[model samples]
Target: MSTHVPFNALRPGVDAADVRAAIDRVIASGWFVLGPEVEAFEAEFAAASQVPYAVGVGTGTDAITLILRALDIGPGDEVITPPLSAAYSALAVMMAGARPVFADIDPARLTLDPHATEAAITSRTKAILPVHLYGQAADMRAFEGIAARHNLALIEDAAQAQLATFDGRAVGSIGIAGATSFYPTKNLGALGDGGAVITRDAQLAARIKRLRNGGQTSRYHHQEAGANSRLDELQAAILRARLPYLADWTKRRRAIAGRYRSASVPPSLSVPREFDAGHVYHLFPVLTSCREAFQAHCLVQGVETLIHYPVPIPRQPALAATNPAMCPVGDRVCAEIVSLPMYPALSDDQVSTVMGAFSSFVPPTR
Candidate 1:
């Protein structure tokens, strides 16, 4: 059997010596939690993001939840977001004591549709949260307009859009607050789990910092209750190693997507239409009515494929009583989406083999 192409190809882009040096430096310092590595990484990440502030946190989920808590968004507040995103997006809202209102996604982009977002708003709505799904920017322009009109905060879920842009500005910099994940597979991934919040507002930055460190003003001096969600020194150092290559990796992802588009795609399958949307192509999702059968076909061809999301949040049993609003587009897309291998480390031959599998696929007969 041929080796299966992986969805993510991690190469440890930094030299082994460099990684060892960083580890040695951190160990020698003996100050791990909320230490210099984390501080320096935050500053570097902020500079790379073109934002004035960056607060490192334990995970992407905590990043979003912390931003919500710092913004004082809780209790009866309702946050409007697309149901097509990771469950963590909705969970963050719930974690902050807010209700997550479901909204439809743009069928073409598979991201939060700004018009649908506005339509889903109620008097209880306090913010508009948009996820930059699949490494392509959401319609931030429209979302910004709607948020301004409604006097709601605009929080961007940039977990997959580390170096992605929207209308000439970095996605994270445009929103009042934004969150990102540095999971091992992200374009600029860390060696382990990590996340951050970016903002231009100084006050919000300070609040997020304090919140991440147990709400302490100084050693055991609790100003207010907060969670222990600080990003650790080891992971921060690893991410710092990867930050410089973000652009190159994103370029590789885009190149792969371009080849996939130009390949012989069967009429039964659909590729995303974001060639000009500054898409980083974190996952190259193809849509087919027979997703399961198509996956089996890929497996038989010695290629591995995965689903970006197999279920829509509105349909989640835990959310049954939130009386989740219907998102027909998101629901339909969820059933049909399949993610092909996507990552910067894929070689040209690997990409060709994956495309060849798609070109030769036959639809399952009903």
Candidate 2:
């Protein structure tokens, strides 16, 4: 029988003993939602990001929407963001009743091109929502300059970049406010879907706290009509348990990425470059002109691979008024990027197996 190495090896209990214990602890507590667990997790997460406050929300999408809504970015407001990203960040803009203006990415980092973001600005542009795609922070220094010049809110979508830093500061802490997800696949994932809006701004944090709780300033007294999107105590507990382990886990992930970078491969394939304190390698993206054949070749070697995004943002039908001409880099990058197996749990043998898969790869013959 062939040994099969999957794209993501994330199994519960065996992989996270503390997570299992936390779940049991929460279950016994009887108070499952918006309790001490959530409060503590929020505090701990805020500390991890070097921020003063973190408001827990139902999901990453809600975190984004709440942050946007708290800032009063709505109706006629335009938020500039990278076109090549998970649809939820852009959709959050829509949820907040704002228009999402697609901007081309820097081909090198695959984050928003600072020039493209600045060029997209108009009187209608009220904010810049930059996604730290694939566990890497964007060039915040450039973005800060742009935001200051235009007086636009700089919000970070840090769903994939838990504990990832840029320059000397944590990614989520640099912007006006940062939204992050704890989806099962994320580096700092909870047991299920969870998210938080972290910020140094106390007023923004207060507004978000109210926004997530049906706009209740107090118990049962509604202030403004808001969505119910509180993060549950159980998930928060799981996150708290896992939080202490993240730094070390990231180190292992870095080691794997280093190996992948040093490995010799076919001329057609190109691995991502390491950025100092910027990338946490959430998904190790490798590009190839011949993506389909490369994926097929890996499959034959009993190694699995997947694409982070197979379709460009403009190509997605759910989004309205999407134009591929507006984001040429994203259009081309989507066609070629493939995610190799990259989770902290991956053994050295598995890493070697993937490297071996690369050595045996053959291009498809016409």
Candidate 3:
């Protein structure tokens, strides 16, 4: 009988007891929103991210939008972003009332190409938003130079990359501000929906905190029109319980990815090169021209596979009015990419099963 390999397992295994304890503690406190648990999680997350401040929000999308709102980037402004990421990255810009300009991705790194981003910038461009796709860091060094030259904010969409570093520097801290999600599938995920903004700017952090809470500097005081997007205490507590185990989980993910990398694959499939050693291996995706057949083959072997994205963000029907520009590289990548099982919960037998499945695949000749 062939061994079955799941794409990911969300049920808490090693941290089950701690997770239960956290939920009980939150229930006992009877403080459900913007309370001590959220406050403490913010500080702890800030330290982990190597940033001075972190503001918890209702979701990752809100975190990105709030960061833009705090920077006063909206309405007539334009933000350059990669087309290959989850549509939420661009939708977050739209939520801020700013238009998101689609930029091509670096074919090798599969990230927002610095050159393409710089080219996309116009006089109205207020920011360059880059998604750290598949847990790999974008070219932050080049992006820093581009932002410096254009006087634009460099915001990192680090939803897939938690505790990932770029050249010894932490990802979220390298940019003006970084946004992350804890949507159960993430590396440092919470029990439910959660997100945060990390930054070194104290004023920006404070502004985001106020902005996330219905624009209130104090109770019943609406200084400006702000969205209600505070990270609740229960989710914060859950995240806190899971946070300490993140480093080890990241290491396990990296080890699994390394095994995948070292495994012999057929000529039809190729793995993307690891651009940085600090990658936390959020999702292990391999490229193949024969996506449908490859997926079928894996499924037969009881190995579940998924596509990271099948369409470029700009191509989504929701963004049709943005007059979205064509991203040739992104379109090609979307057609070819597929994600294999990559989670810390995967056992040694599961890993070997996945490896054997990949090794045995032989693409049908045209």
Work out the TM-score per prediction.
0.97, 0.97, 0.99
Q: List candidate 2 stretches off by more than 4 Å.
A: 13-15, 321-325
Off by over 4 Å in 1: 1-3, 11-17, 275-277
lDDT of 1 at 256: 90
Cα lDDT listed for each candidate: 0.87, 0.88, 0.95
Q: Model 1, range 224-322, lDDT digits (tens) per residue?
A: 898899889988887776677777878888899889889987888888788345778888899999888899888887789999798899888877877
Q: Model 1 residue 72 lDDT?
A: 95
lDDT of 3 at 74: 97
Judge candidate 2 at residue 21 and give its lDDT.
Answer: 87
| Model 3 residue 315 lDDT score | 93
TM-score of 3: 0.99
Query: What lDDT tens digits, residue by residue, belong to model 3 across residues 1-366?
Result: 878898889999999999999999999999999999999999999999999999999999999999999999999999999999889999999999999999999999999999999889899999999999999999999999999999999999999999999998998999899999999999999888999999999999999999999999899999999999988999999999999999999999999998998899888888999999999999999999999999999999999999989999999999999898989999999999999999999998899989988888898988
Best by TM-score: 3
